[model samples]
Target: MRRLTAAVAASLLPGLMVIAIAGLPVPAGAAEPYDAYADEACDGYFDPLLLERGSRCSGSRERSCPTVRHWTPRRVSRQLPACEGVAQAAHPLHAERIQSSYLALRPDHGAPRAIYLMLHWHRATAHEAVNYLHLQDLARSRGALVIVPDVPGNQWAQSGSRNINQHVAWVDAVLADAQRRYGTGNLPVYLVGLSNGAAMAMHYACARADRIDAVMPVALPMYRSDLAACSFSQSIGYVQVHGDSDRFVPYRGNLWFASAEQVYARMRRNMDCVDAGAKAARLESPLTPVDIRYGDGCVGGRRGYLLRVENAGHTWPDMETLSGRDRNPYGLIARNFDATLQGYDLLQLAAGR
Candidate 1:
């Protein structure tokens, strides 16, 4: 239940759906079913009122309504699953943290490629928006059109001001535009993101799971809650990358969010709710150790994956090993992992293409 279509899961929004990361029993004080998050009967459990309209149900699944969400100021002050003061420095390395209120996109190189929707991390700048352009050549090589966009002002804007809904609607418009302008729009749409953008990708997929085919998130999570709340939603192929060495967004998680392991566990239980008994296993990648688990329980044909970067840092899992010294507080990118190629391949599997 995409709440990833493989990449998303958000705060007011939604964990990974799988790959043999780790298994976890439900957390203490965790909501039972997704609807179990409903403590007050203000409106229908899934209705827009409780679900949206400031129902206050979005904070923690344990609460019946949404906790008053404070606006995470864009740029340096972004409110997210923060990295304990390390994000501001760690971010510039991946995508410049300068705030950009609008989105930027790169046209699909050509035909014979699937259309990809790529989102940027929170508080990213327009210039930084091109950070993932390296995937451009790679995607074209795979006959896929990559649409990398800076999330409006660096975030999908998770707020009860009807802000998140509006942002999602805006994305809907953008997808429609991509469909009409780019011929590849009709092709299976795959979402990919880094960090917070990855969460956005997953949340967007869950809300609009019908249209999404696959999702690839690196170093962040948000996907299982909705599945727990409403297992009737569509299944989506899920995959993610995480590093134990990451001080920021560490593999070790918190109560509000999940570590890579917890995300995988939650996904498994959520799938069980729908009777999709996807099993787990270990698989090795060229760069590092990974686990490839599959079952008929997930969306787009019950496929799932997870790449556990051993002793890596707050960086994109790319084929290159960044070794130069930088002033940023966060460290360097993990050396020798091919996120680009792997992402494309995962999408293929997710879409069963």
Candidate 2:
């Protein structure tokens, strides 16, 4: 599983831009076929690529692209198995009550190939995450179980956040519940997040690397606090996608968050990867090609990649439009690359498929 042929790698990421990392060969893996929206008919007006973004095909009088049906998400709510905290004086064992509902999306049929955990950004809900990433459709297509939990107050815990221990415990409980219910035996778990949620993903991935095989954190940098606290014992593959123009979570360091360079350095330290320089991957639109950089020869066959979306903002990259509730107030959206698809592809590579 050390190397993948170019043809094989290309098959996994159909119609997307790619450039090989310097000196590092692509890992062996095949993307599970994603056809959840394959049946929606593409009209003459819109390109077929918009389907993955969960956009309804808006075509003209003449049909041009292939027909497909979008898999509408049915938001299912469930209570996570309770996590116990340190015993109090009167109560020997206390079950931490989770008042918020978590969302789960399962394949229509068959056992899941893997489990995907998605963390939404600050001030965002689980449902908004579904619409923003369209991961529900990915779940349906890949026969994967996707779980999204609503963090307390729509904010994930950070170093300054209250109940940090409790928040981590709740996340562990959610993974346990999802594994028992939908995970195939020994399924590889992948974690993906946006903004503050991205920071949380980095935190949790290092804290509980045994549970997560890889992580994709989009639109935010690693927090200085998180870097101080994180120490990875296992190889949890790391991939970051950030827009350099993101004002809300600046690619450069703000008061709290570290710069993109700092984050990448930390990831390299965690995985023990040697220097792999920037490689340009041109997309359909040459004006906004993604700049890819990574570390190679990481410990335990791991890798870390940072995708710098040119001139992009806080919004998810390369999508046609965001739903009203999912719009980002901070930055401009890049229309050249698909962040969701790129994240997923990177996740699979990290997991060794």
Candidate 3:
């Protein structure tokens, strides 16, 4: 649960580039799994070394290497349950005039192993349901009962309405409704969020830590100083993702919230990690693309992770071409790797699955 031997980590930078007398990029076809398109399309080309270590290439000439490997048809097919389609639903919240909506997605064919709640970013005024289906799709392959909810009135609960008390109550109602229809008696619940929604997930994990088994928050930080009401009474494994180059959520800790590193440090403390004794693991790519720091001697089956994607923006670090989303107007998404699976696998580790 602590150390993830990611395939790339196992590969260990095969065949170090011994430069020619005249300094230049290594000659073409110099390695076994050659980077087919180093100059123009290297970022897009799929690398098996990135996802699973022993997955032999299917040898399909039609395959595109533009994206990373975790979501590959073969590996994903093996990792997730047999799911050909997603079941959708919309249930009313509270039954009063003050209403909330949610989308429920189940695997095409099997009993789910767990329940995953994916919260979307603040919508402001975007009430359209279609704007949030992508959130369900992001977690569809995980073979969980995925519930994606829309924050009523483009907000996760009024800010001054006694903080998370209102938000947590609303969440409990939504989950209870979803479970009545598709309940799998006491399954571990995993929460995922992005941007503002990430803050909500963090607050939920803190306020109601007992109810949550694990949480994955991407690109958002909370004001730790203000969260005295929140408690980590239970050991909860958290896998957080953030871009150092994020423009919207500054990587640097502000007066309001703790920075990404600060959050990880706090996680280590909660998980009982040795003080400042964390060890960093990396995939030796150009500029050290992936850095995973292990919190040594974490007690109570708890895990803490920090996936620092270099040069990544405020968007999720997924392939833009396949996902067809430039979430940010600036098109600053970091597509060189798959951050989704990185966090997903970490959640699995945290849950002891």
Candidate 4:
């Protein structure tokens, strides 16, 4: 039941790793079945060109021709439902869907104070779902809407000029929808991403700082490879989190090169806060109960927080132990951290601007 495995770890790229869990405990209370708007049998739904590549089709295929179908609900349990909800929302938090984009929204319990747009890693619908659920539960408690978009090919950032226009278009649609639904006046908006999604979030934050209040890129690489066009002129806050023992995106440089901390430091320096102070500290959680803290005070005194868990690999921090695979007793760490609270805290810091 342990999620992290040597085989899985070995399959990951230099800056990223994948862990599979047998089963994680679902949240208390009866949860609804994951739903999708797209035809489950449709080929080229998420990746139109994927069909041409002759990838294996797990789901039912209508035509004999090779066609990629929708990733199953169970295969991508965490993301499908939320994406369905967002894409179907009358007033999406951010934007509308592009031709192949998947969008969904988790409505806030009470009047929302702000909106959060979350991006997921490569083909990691289940992780995205779990992360979304944790965030939704937290945001609903605080009255904030959460939006999760399944980017085409899971590319949230405009790396090459290839799909850049399409990516921006989708974001524009979602943001426009969010503004129409939730008055943009003073409602703070935040962008968060994990792994590849983190890269996308950083790309967006740098390029379109006007749209987001803060950016959190988790478990991304250090070199900032394939992401040079991202703009950093705007004054958007950033929080970078990574594990010290992460084999995927290691603390030290890896075979693929540049570490995540290095990338974050470069971004922080670009923001004109290179001389900020650093504080090493520890955080104790009921689950993992480990000592960890970040090198505080990055750009603008916003200090980057890196939670180094000894022997911990690439996985969401502070997550409740659902399976034996998750060694850290503390549940998803990010889940426990109230993003709304984080948003307000960042807003206070940005208020001086």
Q: Name the best candidate (by lDDT).
A: 2
TM-score to native of every candidate shown: 0.60, 0.69, 0.69, 0.62
lDDT of each: 0.47, 0.58, 0.54, 0.46
Query: What is the alpha-carbon RMSD of candidate 2 to the true structure?
Result: 14.4
Q: After superposition, how far is residue 181 of candidate 4 from its true place, in Å?
A: 2.3
lDDT of 3 by residue, 53-151 (tens): 432221112222123122333332112222235555566676333477776767667777777777665542121212222333433455667777766
Per-residue lDDT of candidate 4, residues 1-353 (tens digit): 12223223322322112232443443456355322112343222212122234432112211121111234334434332342112224232334345443343444333565667777665654234333225544343334466666555544543444665557667667666666655654677777666666656666676677777667665664334543444567555666666566666675656453665566566556555555455444332222222323333434444344444444455554332323244332113332222233332333343222
In Å, residue 68's CA in model 2 sits off its true spot by: 17
Q: Model 3 lDDT vs. the true structure? A: 0.54
lDDT per residue, candidate 1, 1-353, as tens digits?
Answer: 33222232332111111001222222366434233223343211221123224442211121111111232223212221221111111211112332323332332333545766777665554334333224433343455555554454456654223466665666676666566655555688887877667666656765776677767777774433533442215666666677666565667764444677767555544333244555544322222334344444554354565667664555565421112221113333332334665456656765556
Ranking by lDDT: 2, 3, 1, 4
lDDT of 3 at 45: 29
The TM-score obtained by model 1 is 0.60
